[model samples]
Target: MFYWLLKYVVLGPVLKCLFRPDVTGLEHVPATGPVILACNHLSFSDSIFTPLIVKRKVTFVAKAEYFTGKGIKGWLMRQFFVGTGTIPVDRSGGKAARAALDTQLRVLLAGSIAGIYPEGTRSPDGRLYRGKTGVARLALESGAPVVPVALLNTDEIQPTGKLIPKIKRVRLRFGAPLDFCRYSGSVGDRFVERAVTDEIMYELMTLTGREYVDVYAASLKTSVEAPRPAAGAFEPLEDRAR
Candidate 1:
């Protein structure tokens, strides 16, 4: 398969030699069954570097734009994503978000590890931002254990808007699996959902040791002309509904 060929024959060996990533706590990942790997989004390379280190075939939900672009470059990008098992998800909210979550749920139900950036988008400032509750929703809905994965120094390799990655050392730390069994059957409640999401974010915070902001990453990057809500006031009722 293209995935193995790239990982073993092409990109994998080369990347390992170049970056010399320090991977820790990989044993925490379940060797089998469905698992959710919730990580902070620091850079575009987060997706690339994660699979290189994790032993399992981890799949992340990537933006649909990556697959829809035109031209030869776009064609290659789409091929690479598909080969790597990246699912295309529309990042737009409302029905699009629902559809994306449905795709993620399917991946989980298939008993494979699913990677998600709870922040919903890459962190423009490298600081950990408030996480969206979609991750919790997925875990609760799928009955999967969520593992908090902290990736250090990926931003240094390929920061926002950088086409090429600088050779740099990176560290990947995977925390123990977080159980949400207590919230089982209550996933529909907004309060319980937000509470569970907050708990997962707190664990991620402890693992990453990054400065936490109460705002979502996407909201912070919105254009100045866009109407802005009061800080922390944008928390949706569905977040608490479960």
Candidate 2:
């Protein structure tokens, strides 16, 4: 299998030697079974490093554009993502959301780990942003436990537009798995979805110790001005938890 070969034999050894990543709470990840790894989106390297560090394969859904680029660079990019088992989702149509969910559900239902970034997009700043509810939807639909993962200092290694990552120490922290069986059969309920997403974001905030912004990260990246937040828009996770 190309996945195992790349992970254990080819790329894994090189990455381990280069990053020397310090990971903690790895025991929280279930050794086997369907599990959802809901991690905060930092750098593009988050995709590469997290999978390399985790023992099991983590299937992630990436933007379709990454797989449809032109030229030799595009070919290499497509090959890398495809080789690593990344699914490409065209986030353009009204059905895009459902398609991505379905893809992830299939992976989870097959007793595999599905890695998702609930924030929808990477944080424009280093601060943590509000998470989207798709992660909660996946958990409820697939009956899988959600593990909150925090990737620290990855943005520094590869900032938003940086092609190559600078050699730096990377850190990952995995929190205890969150069981949502109490909300079984509540997959499409918006209120319940929001609650679950907020809970996951809170855990990520605590783990990364980053300032929590109540705004969606993608909105801030767009040219359209993001609406101003209220007086207490940014707050410490401890204070916000109250």
Candidate 3:
């Protein structure tokens, strides 16, 4: 009830007037039944704009922190996310992965759209990173078609660490639903999981035309701290002690 109220009655009208988002391939999304909208995670705003444009409610597995923040602002944020079909789940470890999958299955079984970001986290760069196998697992388990969604230019509107979004036109492109019926009953198989995830990422690369990076986006933080050059290694050392 709150989801519909916020979407149609309150916030929806305001967002539509501001972004004027250009959406393509709306017909690709199934008008009824369970469907998994697998989208690229770009910005915090991606969570907002994607659901706003889609006709159906998209249940995204949001980080647990958003729901557990402190004080009034936190309370408001929690309400906003909850109203938009955002489910809270800890993404810190493998067990949390299973929990998230279970949550998505329940949503799909109930005949609702499950929105997932296979990349697990937002891209540090614009390049598309390798997706996690959790989405593939959800699709195979629920027998829902994976619809690849490319949310274009959302990062530009509200980038990382910025509170307010700039006024800009954004676009959303939905590709045809991918059926993994051939891979049925292959759940928990590492090889099959990787294949399914790669295939989805491949289609996303083609649809979005962004550079493909085979590593996880979370590793970017580690890369920053990776073994720095020892004190100006590039500089000439005392002219080789001539």
Candidate 4:
């Protein structure tokens, strides 16, 4: 009830008229059944825009911080996300991964589309990063097909740290559903999972045309913290001494 109300009444008309997003390959999405919408996350609005264009109800695992903020704006944001059928997920590693996957598995088991960003977080540099194996695990465990969705130019409208979005057109390209029925999970045969994950990311790369990085999105944080020489610093002690 609330989903329809928001989609048809509140936001649907406005968003449709404003951004006028070009959605392609929507027919590739199964009319009904459990499936995974694996997408490349570009901006905060990726969550909102993707669902708006799709005809069926698509649920995503949103960051828990969006639900647990302070004050009135936070309250409204939480309500909106909840109304849209998003599940709050803790981004912490290990135990949190298990818990979040538990929720996603339940959603898939219930025969609904579970939207996931295989890269696990928004692309800080707009390049597709290596996907985590969790997406493959869910698809394999749930026996659901994976659909690769590429969102284009959404970041141009609303980038990270920008409170308001600029009026700009966006494009959403949905690739054909990827079938991974060939590989059976066997003892010590973890390569299947890696192969499945790599296949999905490769399709996403082709659709989005972004440079592929072999590193996981989470590892980029460490890259930022690694030591860097100061600007214009000499490369060697001899040069500094001179």
Candidate 5:
């Protein structure tokens, strides 16, 4: 109810008016049934604008901190995420990571759309980073088609640490759904999962036309102590990942 109200009546109108998102290839998304929207994470607004454009409700897993903060700001953040169809999960790996995967699997098996950022975290630079295998696991386990989605220019609208977004036109593209049913029984296989993850990342690279960085975005964040990448220091795709 709140989701509908926010999308159609309250926040949707305001966002549509301000950003005027230009979306394409929406027909690629199936009208019903479970599906995975594997997207490249560029900015915080990727979450906001994706649900706004897609007709069906998109369920995304956000870091647990977003739901566990203190004060009124925390309450507001929690409400916003919930209303936007986001659930909180501990992104810290190990048991917590498995739990998060289980949560999303439930959502998918229940015949709902699950939006996943395969890159694990937002790109520090504009370049697309290597994807995490969680998306592959979800697709293989759920047997849902994976749709490669690219949200262009969202970073400019709401870059990291920017409270207010600048008024900018957002563009979104949805590619044809990828079927990995060939690897149906290979969910737990690390090599198969890596291949699936790479395939999804390749589609994202083609869709967004961004440079491909084989390193995980989270690792780069730790090295620099921030999300900003050092200029001209990325590895060549052929020389690095291969």
Candidate 6:
């Protein structure tokens, strides 16, 4: 298939030879099992190099537009995402957000590793943002072990909005797997999900050592002239609910 071909034939060999990405704690990855590889999002290339360095296929929950785009560039992107085993997700959130979790569950139940960014989207600024409960919901619902992964120096290789990335050595660090079996049957409990999500964010923050911002990344993109919440008051995490 295109996935294996690209990995072993085309891009894989080139990436491995060029950057020779460094990885630590790789032994933490289970030899075989359904697990969640929760990673910090730094650059768009984080998606590419994250899986390239791992032994198992890491299915990322990418935006649907990558698969639905048009024209020659669209065709190439669609093929790349598909060949890389990336799942298209609607970032609209709410019911759509739950749907994305369901899709990830399907991948988990099949015993494949699902790669997810707890931040929900790439950080416009590099600081870490609060994680969404969907990751907690997925973890509890499927009972998969969560491995915190840190991808370093990828932003330098391919920064935001750049089409081509220069060759640069990168680091991929995998952390201890976290088990939330105590909260397994407690799905839909807002308190429990928030507790679990915060725990996951703490792990990511610890691994990456990035400053933690208590808000979603998208909210920071709003126009300065847009209606703003009162000082010291921000949208509740449950309002956006993804």
Per-model CA lDDT versus the true structure: 0.83, 0.87, 0.85, 0.84, 0.87, 0.83
Candidate 4 colliding pairs, count? 0
Give candidate 5's error at residue 77 in angstroms: 1.4
Off by over 4 Å in 5: 225-242
- Model 2 residue 217 lDDT score: 84
RMSD of each: 7.7, 4.8, 9.4, 8.7, 4.9, 7.6
| Model 6 score (lDDT) | 0.83
**lDDT tens digits by residue: candidate 6, 152-227:** 5676677677888878777778999999998868989999999998998898888776668898877775533223
- Residues 111-229 of candidate 4 have per-residue lDDT tens digits of 98999999998876677789988898888888889999988677677877787998877778999999776764631357888889999999998888667889987799557743322
Best by TM-score: 5
List candidate 3 stretches off by more than 4 Å: 225-242
Per-model TM-score, in order, reads: 0.89, 0.91, 0.91, 0.89, 0.92, 0.89
User: Which consecutive 10 residues in model 2 have the weakest lDDT in total?
Assistant: 227-236
In angstroms, give how far residue 175 of model 4 lies from its true place: 0.2
- Model 5 C-alpha lDDT per residue in residues 92-145, reported as the tens digit of each score: 789998888898899999999999999888887778998999999999999999
What is the model-wide C-alpha lDDT for candidate 1?
A: 0.83
> Candidates 1 and 4: which is better by lDDT?
4
| Local accuracy of candidate 1 as per-residue lDDT tens digits, 1-242 | 99998788888999999999888899999999999999988788899889888878888989999999899989988887898899888777888888878888988999998999998998767677888889989989999999999886677777777888998777788999999988889877888888878888888777776677888878878843333223223222432254
- The lDDT, on a scale of 0 to 1, for candidate 5 is 0.87
What does candidate 3's lDDT look like per residue over 178-240, in tens digits?
Answer: 999999999889999899999999988877767788988888745763332232232223322
* Candidate 2 TM-score, true structure as reference: 0.91
| Colliding residue pairs in candidate 3 | none
TM-score for candidate 5: 0.92
